[model samples]
Target: MDTVKQSLKEASIFTHSQERPFKCSDCGSNFKRAADLREHERIHTEERPFSCSHCTKTFRTSSNLRQHQRVHTGERPFTCSVCGKGFTQLSSLLKHKVTHTQERPFKCSDCGRGFKSSGELMSHKRFHTAEGLFTCSVCGKGFNRSSHLQTHQRVHRFKSSSNLRKHHRVHTKEKPFPCSVCGKGFTQLSSLLKHKSTHTQERAFQCTDCGTGFESSHELLIHQRVHTGERPFSCSHCTKRFKRLSTLRIHQRVHTGEKPFPCSVCGKGFTQSSSLLRHNVTHTKERPFKCSD
Candidate 1:
């Protein structure tokens, strides 16, 4: 009882001290205590000590890890008070609570972009850095963001040929983005996000100072490299800079002369399957893009 009284007295003294000692160097933000300073340090460091075992993914905090584990365990403890819809995490409930308050605290620093939750900001950051780590094994293509890779992989899973053609158009469009040094084109805003990394020399997707900046933000990352100069996808022995791994494979043929694509009508050899795919249409007199039939 005496110990409790002493602790209470110390707390009262702190409240009266008028001291705000904890200050952040990166954002110039202030905190009331040292512990908060340490916690806030993780934002600048991008260090996530907590990790999930299932997918071998890392999270910044234990609370995020606990929330993620619920997805694996199917534990939906949070429920809507009015609708009774369940979520595996309390954060989900808080997000659902936004429909009631219309509160959006999280926002983008590079742009005036706002999100209802921090997770949304987490997802949104993918566009600024253009870091996509996941890859499609069959095509040997990488993406900066998982959601974009998810969206692209779905194109391959599409059962309809018509849908596939529509999906293919996304790969060959003239979409544009702001130029950090030189204005270039990108298929997704996230690729532009990763491209901005090249001009800023800002590799937020780094492992260390010696670590590289090659995390993927979208599938078909050929559109991402107008920003940075580091070319990771290369032939084991040769020196070549390719924006896409698929292009690097095609370039390797210059050394090997190994033509995988052959024209059906004339039996002519080519280095790329895309070249063959486009050439075959010419031989068949098929302007697939302009077809009225």
Candidate 2:
């Protein structure tokens, strides 16, 4: 009877009781448990107590650190029963499960649109409100979102007609600017300038682990990942992780069956541009690789 009473008391405390004894001094947020208050206080203090063994990244909670470690291990414990899809986090799996359901619990009052979650409905409500309205002065174009206006404003950034004509190369896929070192074509002069640095053999950023030099800090950070064994980018569809986000994006194409690269000669699609280039050699009867033995 005493055990049953204790269980009932605990259940009531979680479900019905509003009394929270533990309070955060920084945020004034109340919690039923001291551990909860400690976690909440970290947000205000900007304290990251838990550190990852594999990398320099740190987290406020041990659970977050454990999740971060999965990036290196490429572990996806959460699996969907319907499609057999894997996700790194349980919350992501839960979000994926909503796609299989036809039921929309939240309905928008403004447009009568149905959404699976309350967060979606709230985002939809923003379109009906003037809360995020933005306008462009150059073209007098209106956008419901500020981000759309910012992207549209880029067209107006180039004041001169010659600069605007140069920017049009991005849409036309024109590469007038060629690198003097490798003869590699680039659409912009700025890209050609950056490409020339690769041939200079002047790598300013040096890695402490292997004494490897990189042209830029970004390149150095990516090279450091080799020594750290850190693969930060994880595929949403599978347990595979990648050191680079671009590699992860390419890996996702396997799951999505998206072949963006197409052979102009054969109209055949390839998941990667390199694959298309290799297939093009078949038409030319060029055997680049041969067995020496």
Model 1 regions lying over 4 Å from their true place: 12-19, 94-293
Q: Candidate 2's residue-wise lDDT over 1-293, tens digit each?
A: 99999999987877677888898886678898888888888898899999998988889999999998998999999999999998889988887788788767678897776776554555456578764445788778776544466678889799899889888898998999998878999987877876778898788789998888877778899888898999999988867899998888778766644566756775445668899999899789789899999
Clashes of 2: 0
What's the TM-score of each model vs. the native? 0.32, 0.49
Could you give me the TM-score of model 1 versus the true structure?
A: 0.32
Candidate 1 per-residue lDDT, tens place, 94-198, comes to: 888865564667778988666665655555565576545558766757775443565677756878886576566587774655656787876556667777777
Residue 279, candidate 1: Cα error in Å is 47
Local distance difference test, candidate 2: 0.80
Worst lDDT window (10 residues) for model 1? 215-224
Residue 106 displacement in candidate 1 (angstroms): 14
Assess each prediction's global lDDT (C-alpha) against the native: 0.68, 0.80
